[model samples]
Target chain A: MSLQLLFDALSLGGIYAIAALGIALIFGVMQLVNFAHGQFIACAVFALILPSSQAVAELGLGRLPTPLLIPVILGFGAALALLAEAAVFRPLRNAAPVALMVASFALGVALQNLLLVIYGSRPKAVSLWAGLGHPVQIGGAQVPLLQLLVIGAVALILAGLALMLKHSRIGLEMRAAAQDFGMARLLGVRANRVISGAFALSGALAAVVALVMVAQTGVADVRMGGQIMLIAFIATVLGGMGSLAGAVAAGFAIGAASALLQMALPAEARPFRDAFLYGLVILVLLFRPQGLFAPAGAKPRV
Target chain B: MLSQHTIRRRMAASTPLVLALGLLAFVLLATTMGDRATARMATETLIRVTLVAGFWIFVGNSGVVSFGHAAFACVGAYVSAWLTLKPAMKGTLLPGLPDLIAAADWPALPAVLTGGALAALLALVSGAAILRLSGIAASIATFAFLAMVNTIWANWTPVTGGTSSVVGLDRYVTPWVALGWAVAALIAASLYGLSASGLALRATREDEVAASASGIDRYRHRLLAYVLSAFFCGVGGALMGHFIGVINPDAYYLNLTFLMLAMLVVGGIGSLSGAVAGVLALSLAVEGLVRMEKGVTLGATTFALPAGSQEIIIAAAMILVLIFRPAGLLAGREITLPARWVTGRGTTHNGPATDRRET
Candidate 1:
């Protein structure tokens, strides 16, 4: 039971970590919380199927061989993010953070509505690698193959991101921009290049989340991304707004807390798990409003 | 000779009066010329005015964006539902409601006031903890608060009917009733904006360090505004329940939260006039698009936008507005006596003399 619970926690945590990374990437550089990110994830999930008002998704990209499917879906996500940047965000780059936030929200609404127009309001079923749902016995425990895969994927992605941020030139620029945008610009970091780079990486991470979530649930829902997106957003804040590593760690912590709370709470009280989780969030903010792993200069000097 | 102070004060009072009159005129026009549907729409718009004005009280003055006001609205709606529903219906639909509440069936006015009072009490309790934080952190905390309230409301099935719509609310809201509450809300907001704490709060918003140095208690003032704002929002929620004749937890969820915020932002979060104007303009545009979606007869043919295109178009419009006019259409100014008209020609008054101080 313990080992199964451990797998459950890690799988949920992995999904949230990737989603948080996507949000943190954009926030680090631009100081804009992209509220439309949930929509981006939803769009990626929808991309797997042909556009139709029918209840069942016709496997469009999902029918492709794995090798071609991965790259195409990731590209779709990246292109969507880039299109949004050019069409909406880029024009309002110089506006106040609040204005940018509101615009992103508007963009999210537009995307959701567009999806509704194309696919209708009902949730669609998309079967991909259903064979992976089989439980595998390991070390006196039963864990699903997909859960193991999700954990591995999360680890691989985190390591790759760490190396990229450490060694790549664009990664260095992204870090600088996230740390201090005005100073980075003054110091000659290319603004448009870094911003676009961050958006691309964020979009790719969103796609990764979409694929995992679809695999786990065996369903594609326009509304599916919102719940995870909200949890990931909280993780980003709890980990510190611009801190990628912090976001990942906080994501894991939140997932673990949720799993344990579900296990420990009485059946009658289990429905209130989110209420308890969010209450903890408020308490954490009261104690350390800058977040647990906040970077330097997060607090006001005055 | 009247001093500048007295003139500014009178203009400050004039702003709300002007806004109330404008709203009243719209209500009257809708009632006289339009059908019942238009009257209902007008009522919805007025209820929104009350909400947005309530929203502006805190956000405009404190520069803090709150996502939890809808939770207060939720509280108000449910409270009003508990009060106004037939006691027999309550017994069946809300078995978990305390015996006293289940047994009592009250009229609408007192029910609405009690709903607002409950929400104000909640704001006071929550704000005591939440207002201690500042900036984006406070905003996030409010979001969490909203999530918490929603979760509880969804699960507390016996009392709230859980995720299902709680029906049987009396449809007591007319265009005139909405106008009356909206005017009351506007007057409250306007009076608060010109109050000493309101000025101090705005000062803190502009420059927190400077305001603190000048002896303003930012947290205290913020809490006061929050409580006052929650009261009107709660009333607005009760009014919405009466208007729609149904109350649902989902109605006051993130969708409503964002809708209210979008209205506030598009109107210009900086001033009262911006709030009022934003609601009127956007509500009109939305009503028009909704009609077009139902199909419009233009000259020879009936044309309709794609079924879901109204939301997409509205969202795109909001984004465009932000891109072009980030401070919103009003840019933090108010409708006031024109300098040319008030001071007469050749004086060439520099600006709206009392506008900046009022905002």
Candidate 2:
């Protein structure tokens, strides 16, 4: 039982960590909180299936074999992100953080409504890697094979991201830009290159999250990404705004806490679990407004 | 004999008065001349005006984008519903309400005020902790507060009716009543914008370090604006409940939050006039789109936009507006009398057209 809970927590946390990383990357390079990131996730999911109001979603691009399908989805996500950057974000690059945030929100609304127009307002079932749902016994706990794969995928992505950030030229520039964008630009790091790279990377992560979510739920709804996006947003802030490691750790911590709360709470109080969780978030903010993992230098100057 | 300072102050003051009169004329025209549907739209627009203006009282002055004001509205709506619903109705619908509330019946007027007061009280408590943070952290805290409120309201089944709608509200908020509230909101927002606390708050917004250095308490002023802002939001929420004759937790959630925020931002987040203008402009545009979706007869054929296209178009319009004029349509300027009209023709007025005090 304990092992099963652990896997559940890890899998859920991995999804949030990926989403939070996507949000944190753009926020690191630019101060804007990309509210449209949710739509990006939803768009990627819907791209897998054909546009129809039918109960069973017909496979569109999803019909491709796994090896080909993964790259297609990632590319689509990156292209979408690039298009949004060029159209909406580029023009408002110099606006206030609040203005940028609002613009992103408007973009998200437009995208979500567009999806609604195409797909209709109903959940559609799609069977992708249906065999992966089979239970695998490990240490006397029955866990789905997909849970282990999700964990493995998240670990691989994190490792790859970390290695790239540590070594590659674009990666180093991204780190420098994240730390201090203006300073990095002054030191010859290309602003457009770094921002675009961040957007593309963020979009790919969103696509990965979409794949994982669809594999788990086997259903795609227009509203699917909204809840996870909200939770990921909270995790991004809790982990500290621009701190990548912090975001992942905080995401895992929240998932663990949520899973534990589900087990611990009385039946009557279980429905209010999110209230307790969000209340705890406010308390955490009160005590550490700079975030739990933010570097000392990141603190706002009086 | 008016000094230049007095003349400018009066001119500045006329902005809100003119806005109020404009709303009043709209309400009168709609209620008197137009059909029932027109009156309903006008009433709804005025309620939005009240909400947006109330929201501006905090956001415009403190320069803090709060995602939590809709939660306050939700609270006010529920609270008013608790007080005004028939006693037998409450017993059946919300059996968990304390005997004092469940047994007593109240008139709409006092109940609405009570709702606002309770929401203000909630803000007072929440803002104390939330105001301590600054910048995006504060904004995140507000978002968390909103989530917590939403969760509680959505799940507190016995008292809140969970996700179900509470129906049979009195619908006392006619166009004129909504106009009264809207005009009152505009006046209150304008007064707050010009008050010492508002100025101090805006000072903090512009340059926090400098403002704090000048003996201004940023937290105190922010909390003051927050409480005041929530009061009006609560009132707006109560009025909305009465106007629609139904209240649901979902109605006051993210959709309302985004709608209010969109209106505020599109109108220019800097000025009171911008808030009112944004609401009116967007509301009218949305109404026209809704009508178009219902089909419009032109000559030989009837044409109509597809359903849900209005939301997409409006969002696209917002993006275009932001791209073209980042500061919003009015660009933080109040709709005051022209400088030449005020100063007389001979001297060319060289002062900036924008409201310097706001931005």
Retained native contacts per candidate, as fractions? 0.74, 0.69
lDDT tens digits, residue span A109-175, model 2: 8888899888888899999989999999999999999999999999999999999999999999999
Candidate of highest DockQ: 1
Please, what's the RMSD in Å of model 2? 3.3
Clashing residue pairs in candidate 1, if any?
A28-A178
lDDT of 1 by residue, A1-302 (tens): 89888988998888889999999899888888888999999999999998876777789989999888888888888889988888898998888776787788789888988988888888988898789999999888899999999999999999999999999999999989988889999999999999999998888889999999888898888788777877888898899888998999999989998999999999999999999998887788778878889988777677
Worst 10 residues of 1 chain A by lDDT: A96-105
Provide per-model DockQ scores: 0.66, 0.65
Estimate, for each residue in B1-359, the C-alpha lDDT of model 1 and write its tens digit: 55667666766668887788778889889999999889988999999999999989999999988889999999999999899899999988999999899988899999999999999999998888788876766776787789889999999999889999999899999998999999999999988999999999999999999999999999999999999999999999999999999888989987788778878877788889999988988888889998998999999999998777877887887887798877777888876554344333446656535343222
TM-score of model number 2 = 0.95
Q: Give TM per candidate.
A: 0.95, 0.95
